[model samples]
Target chain A: MSIGIDELEDLAVGAAFLGTGGGGDPYIGRLIATKAIQDCGEPTVLDLDQVKDDDFVVTVAGYGAPTVQIEKLIGEGELEKALAKLEQHLKKKVTAIIPAEIGGSNSLVPIALASRCKLPVINADGMGRAFPELPMNVFSFNGISASPMIVTDEHCNTAIVETASDRTAEKITRAIAIELGLRVFIGCYPMTGRMVRECAIEGTLSQAIAIGRSIRQRPPGSCAIESLMHCLSTIYPDRESRVLFTGKIVDVQRDTADGFSKGSFRIEAFGSGQSAELIFQNEFLRVCVEDKLVAVVPDLICVVDEETASPITTGALRYGQRVKVIGIEAPPQLCSEQALTYVGPECFGMDFPYKSIATLEAEAADKAPKSATAV
Target chain B: MSIGIDELEDLAVGAAFLGTGGGGDPYIGRLIATKAIQDCGEPTVLDLDQVKDDDFVVTVAGYGAPTVQIEKLIGEGELEKALAKLEQHLKKKVTAIIPAEIGGSNSLVPIALASRCKLPVINADGMGRAFPELPMNVFSFNGISASPMIVTDEHCNTAIVETASDRTAEKITRAIAIELGLRVFIGCYPMTGRMVRECAIEGTLSQAIAIGRSIRQRPPGSCAIESLMHCLSTIYPDRESRVLFTGKIVDVQRDTADGFSKGSFRIEAFGSGQSAELIFQNEFLRVCVEDKLVAVVPDLICVVDEETASPITTGALRYGQRVKVIGIEAPPQLCSEQALTYVGPECFGMDFPYKSIATLEAEAADKAPKSATAV
Candidate 1:
């Protein structure tokens, strides 16, 4: 299927929502992807099942602190050049490009490269949502290595890292990212088509598009947010997706260090004393109301503009802005015990035990007053 | 000339003295070189003039904090593997190996790899004495690029860094070195034999061997330290090498950070109230006696056993130890206006202008009491 400008816009919107306040700014990515499509024809989007068993697939993404992107935008040609370097190192042509993670900008960056290179982009992605680190995905949990990875910066500097473990690869790449000014394009996690079929999150690109379509094409009399929530619940009944809170951002404390944008923000419910706090490392990992976690990683926690329902990424969060927080269950593969080790609360330095969004929400409901609090 | 275990040992000792208390521990490197010679054949040491201009010459050395080597040893196979990676990247065979810097362990590491790989070892080097960082070498000062550089750890992990400037290359390599636990082998400064002859400090290896010989093959009736000093003065008459001071170490302070061993030490005259202090960053760059400047980089400052002339490294310095400090004029190449910008006192954060050891020594002599005090 050829993805046109309309599909690209919808994909960006849905990716921003799914990004849960990390990834990168959608506007910048949409512009770049849009330009690529116009200049070099629409990108071919292929389903996971369409790729042959023997085909080679490579995941492409930007790796660095998102805060750095606010001032230093992703420039043209870095992604294409980095992918070319990876191809040269492997001595093989890539069968298709796959997003390492689905995010506002990240989901489309690969597609832009695919358009220019005239390669197909797989509908699948490693992480259904954006993640801060490379190894926190199903591919790593399923024993796939992240090595033989190439990282490149705008200055044309390239570093090829090959190591034994995904953890080491992440470390080496992060070190390079810090030295290279915290913005880099990585061509990594080289895998076979069979591996992608077996381990990747399927149809993420299409799912993002569907979620975005609901927000854009709400019924004339119906509220856009209601339509979006309805669309999300209908699409992810198993995920138990829902709006958890609507409030004004009260405070935020963020700082970039060691190539990571890490901090937390507080929000107070409208006309209520109740509040929620969300702590993040690139992507929002934990959201709590009254010291009780309503959502936690690898579950999804997202912030969207209250009235318009457009996604607001972690980097764009501002004090006194009205927003709504949403929570959705993680994919089944990522919810496994083995997968949790890579994205669990403990993995992010939180000592709390793992609790599904369902269990946590039900517990919070049980503690609230009969009328149900706004937060 | 075939470098036997005896010559290797002498080279290590002399390199340690020239290491200016940085480089790495000589005993560790000497043992490794000795074993390599026994396993393979003797390393063929060739003069700088022996090779043709088109021959491919690569410098091989370890890059990281020398203090780290004291606890974690330099293992086997890393250099050979890293060198092979570099060769594969360039798609050409390395015709010869040269020391990136001449120091206790660094000067001998390339020779050891040369013995095993059956490649001739260049008698010359980039830095006649060691400095903490890569760009501080004459090779970089002479417009040599340090990129297309490959760094490898004992874990078999390799990183290839390519950039426009040697300074950026050093920063990237150092970042990786910190992540790799501060002990890494690097195959960098890829240049032709013509570049080596044009820019390299010629005969550094042979000069180190000679300095070691004076300490070992001293005239029966003469003091070993005296013989060593006489040998140094003869070898670098333009440098005017001499013993600068003799005293007990009264105080010392050091710490390892960002892949460098940096600190200062104080020495008190045996019976007099006068004292001297030397500051270093992996290498001793400056020394002051009676609050008067005595030596500074790009000059050479060394610490040796007061009676035996065995070089003592910065990592091995201890309070209350008796020692003699030696200072030698820097090579003419490094003393030039452009070269000083790379290794001058200001490069290491010293604000004082760089003054030659000859001038500083003459000034100190003029201020001294007639008949001269021991300090």
Candidate 2:
């Protein structure tokens, strides 16, 4: 299946939801990706099973803090140059572009590069949800090296990181991005088609597009939030979703430091004696109600505008804005004992242990009074 | 002339004197360079006129704070790897190695690599004396791009910086060096034989070796310092050398910041109660006696032990140590108006005006009382 320019908005919206309140605002990405399609024709997106074992897959996305990203959007030829450099280093043609993470701008960057290069995009991604760091992905969890990676600034100043571990690669690339003003494009994690099938979280592109469509459908009398939850369960029966908080943002704090947007925000329930707080580092890492952890990393914590049900990235959150926070369970692979070591609550330095959104919500329901509700 | 295992000491000693008060300690470099010559046999040395117009000349050196470099030495294979990566990027064979700067470690790195790769080392250098930053080189002074350069750590985590201005290349590499523990090897300033012949400071290697020998000769009835100054005049009548002060180090301060050993040290004359202050970032930038400027950057401000007459690097300075501060005029090209724009005192953020070492010494001589001797 290929993504036409018309469906780009739907994809962006869905990607924003899965971005977990990070991945940057997708409006600019949508514009660039749409223009790329018009200039070079819609790109073909391939399913994981469609690629042969010998095919070479490359990952492309922006690497930097989300706050800095929106201020200085990707410039012309940055993507083309990075792709060319990556191919030159690999000494072979890239078969397709895979979104390193299925989140707003990260997803769109690959599609845009794909259209410009006349290449296909893999339907799956390294992480089903967005992560702030490079190694916080399934590819790293699967022991893939992130080297031989090509990074490019808007002015075409490029560097090729070769033969570094994923951890050192992250530090090197992050320091570079910070030195280059906190935003640069990277084409990393060169993998085989077989590795893609074995390590990637499948159907993320399609799933993101469908999630975008469900929120926009807005059936009469059916709350968009309720419909979005229904859509999640409909797509993945094993996964669960819940409305963690419905409130107005009271205090939102952010500081761009060490190549990340770090801070937390407080939310007060509308016309109710309940409140919640969400902590984030580029992506929302944890959501807590009355100091009790409700949803943590490796799970989605999507913040949406209350009336329009439009996804709001972490950078777009504002004080006094009415919003709904949704917690969706991650795929089983991301929550496994092995995977948790890389993306779990502890990996993010949270004091508490990792708990499934479903389990946390069930525990809350059991503790609450029969007729009363608590945030 | 090819440098054999025997002349390595003379070369290091001379390079250290030319390095001013920085360029790191040469003890370790001497040890490693001696082993390289023994392992690979003697390497050929090429004069400026030796290389053809089409020959490719690559510059190699270590880049970081001098204080950090000595603590964690360069491991085996680091040089070989950087050279291989650089050559691969050029897609052409490097005909010879050129010292980017003729200073302690910087000068020896080339000889070691030349032996390892069976290549000749150019007898000239980018800077006749070491300057802290990349843009301070004559290659950059001649408008050569510092890109297509390869940098590597001891662990072989390599990155190739290509297509950036020398200034930007410095920032990128510096940030990476800091992130990688403040020391890394770089192969940069890829130039043609024509460029090297036109832009390089010629014969600095042979001069360094001669200076090294003059200091070691220590002729009886005449001070070694006196003999060293005589050697300087004999080699280049166009240049002048003066002992700025003979003192005991009173206060030494240093802070490794922004990938540089930055600080100022004060020295007091042995019995005259006179004092001098030398300010440095990596190499000595300025020397002042009684708060009056005596010498500024783009000139050599070498510090040596009073007893041994051996050059002491900036990192080796200690309180209460008796030393002789010598000021030597830089090569003619380095003092030219065009060259000063890149390495003048103003470039180091000092407010003093540019004056030759001879001019500063003459001014100090005119200011002192007829029978009074001051530091």
Best by lDDT: 1
Cα miss at B279, model 2 (Å)? 1.7
Off by over 4 Å in 2: A363-375, B364-375
Docking quality (DockQ) for each candidate: 0.85, 0.76
Q: lDDT at B245 for candidate 2?
A: 87
The lDDT values for all models are 0.88, 0.87
Residue-by-residue lDDT tens digits, candidate 2, B1-375: 778877899889999989886665677678778889989987899999998899898999888899988998989878988898888878889998899898888888899999989999999998898889987888887888888999899999899987658888888888888888888899998889999999899999999999998898767888888888888888878878888889999999999998899998999997789999998998998999998888888888899988777998889889999999988888878877888888998899977668987787677788789787643
Candidate 1: tens digits of C-alpha lDDT, residues A1-375:
567998988888999998888877788779889999999988788898898898888998888988886667666787888888888888888988999999988998888999999999999898899999989888899999987899888888889998888988999999999999988888888989999999999989998998888887778888878989998888787778888889999999998977899999999998878999999999999999877788999888989888888888889999999999988888887888899889888999999877888998788778889765763
lDDT of 1 at B27: 89
What TM-score number comes out for model 2?
0.97
Least lDDT summed over 10 consecutive residues: which range in candidate 1 chain A?
Answer: A69-78
Q: How accurate is candidate 1 locally (lDDT)?
A: 0.88
